[model samples]
Target: MRGVVMYKPGDVRVEERDDPRIIEPTDAIIRLSATCICGSDLWPYRGAEPVDHQVMGHEYVGVVTEVGSRVHTIKVGDFVVGSFFASDNTCEICRAGYQAYCVHRVLMGALGTQSELARIPLADGTLVATPGHPAPDLIPSLLAASDVLGTGWFAAVAAEAGPGKTVAVVGDGAVGLLGVLAARHLGAERIIAFSRHADRQALARYFGATDIVEERGPAGVDRIKDLTGGLGAHSVIEAVGTQEAMMQAIHATRPGGHVGYVGVSHDVALPGNELFMSGVHLHGGPAPVRRFLPELINLIWNRTIDPGKVFDLALPFDRAAEGYDAMDKRAATKVLLTL
Candidate 1:
């Protein structure tokens, strides 16, 4: 089988690799139909995050080719969407809707889904079977549900977005863009998106953002407050994990408001005094993509929302290096690698 491997920074290649086979009674092998390059992947590509012969990619949607003996919920020939974090789905943490922290969790990203075939552990708990083999056009949207859409949905939920709430989103990447969409689906009355890119701003508007603030740091915070009648937003979703984005999220929320962040933190540190003085609620981490997979799949299946628009570029699976380059250079919002 051929898959993506990162030999070092700025050096990702598609090369022959040993094919995956069932190693656990609870595992299943999938022939990937679609996968993607995530913003997080760039961390390693830029050498901000270290890697040594790493198998790349986690977001995927595909057909089950074989199932383990104990896998009953999913089966062969079933088209599915699985979470990036594999969980038993019945664990205490999962029962509490935090499958990302499942006691028996596994980080599927480490195994890599950017390949022709891959093995998925805890298949019954991780994979969600679609209603049927979906139409070809729905593939991109369903693929989004696998990670970016689900993460954005979780961000909205964490931010407490709902009818009558004024929400602000930090960042304008795929996850941030989809955060705008998720907030809309959650019924936020006013969505303020922070973005400097005209294309992203347009897409943000299409996703229901009422305002766009191109400024960053304190100026951006002021802009958000200015748009919210000097009170800032009631809910702020931080989709970029930079210190600047995190501080923007915190400072742009009104007193007693909530700030939900889903960006992978990179050298971020919050001042205890600032947070103490802000009088706002802060909660976020790696999103339990599994928790929201069902509802998200339904929305995509029924054609109610289209998160697939985030994929501005799509390339063949073998051209993953090119996809990575486009994203690394900010030339693409998100890149979809089709098999």
Candidate 2:
């Protein structure tokens, strides 16, 4: 089987590896159809995160080729979308819609979805099959639901965005941009996206943002407050996990507003006094995508939302290196790898 491996930081290779097998009874072998690199993947590629000489890439959609005897909900030939965290649906966390925190969790990137094949453990609980079979048009939404969309949705939900609420989005990465769309779909009355880029700003408007702020840090917070009649937004989505973005989100909301944060957290340390004085509700972490997959699929199937707009660059799986480079250089909002 062919796979992309990161031998070390800045060194990524598409090479051949022994095909994976059912090492556990709950495993299921799958043939990947589409997969893409994620913004979070950059953390390791840039050497900020540890890079072991192992496989890379996580977001994927595939066809099941084999299922263990213990797996009954899914069988061979089923096309499915699995969460980054392999979980048992019946577990307490999963039952509470927090499968990403399942008692037994398997990180998706470690499983390497950027290959011709993959072995999905906890098959019945981790994978969600499309009703019967999904058409090609639905692929992107299914793919998005696996991560970015789910993350954005989680952020919006955490921020408490809903009808009559004024929501402000901080950051313009794929996830941040998608947060604009999620806030709109969730019924926010006003959305302010803080973006300076022409392309991302345009998409933010298309996603229903009523305003765009080009400022950064304090200036941005001031602008948001000015736009919201000095009360700040009722809800704020913090899609960038940096100290600045996190603080901006914390301060961009009303005294009692909620802040939804879904950026892959890094170097963030919030002081107790700051949060206490702000009185802003903060909630978000690795999105439990499993919880949103069903409704996301339904909305996509009905064409209510198109989360796939995040995919700005598409390349064959073999050119995974170029895909990574483009994103690393900020030349692409996201890169989709075609299998």
Q: Which candidate ranks first by lDDT, i.e. highest?
A: 1
Q: What is the lDDT of candidate 1?
A: 0.93
Error of 2 at 25 (Å): 1.6
TM-score of 1: 0.99
Per-residue lDDT over 1-339 for candidate 2, one digit per residue giving the tens place of the 0 to 100 score: 889998887788899998999988899999987888889988889998999887997787889999998998988999888888888889898899898899987897888888999999899998988776777767777888889888898899889899999999998998898899999998999999999999999989988889999998999999998998999999999988899999999999999999999888899999899999999898999999888887887888788999888888889889999998999998998888888
Which pairs clash in model 2? 159-260
* Model 1: per-residue Cα lDDT over 235-318, one tens digit each: 999998999999999999999999999999999999999999999999889999998888999999999999999999999988
Candidate 2 Cα outliers beyond 4 Å, as residue runs:
none
C-alpha lDDT (0 to 100) for residue 263 of candidate 1: 96
Show the lowest summed lDDT stretch of 10 residues, model 1. Answer: 223-232
Q: What is the C-alpha RMSD of each candidate to the true structure, in Å?
A: 0.7, 1.1
Model 1 RMSD in Å is: 0.7
Which stretches in model 1 have alpha-carbon errors above 4 Å? Answer: none
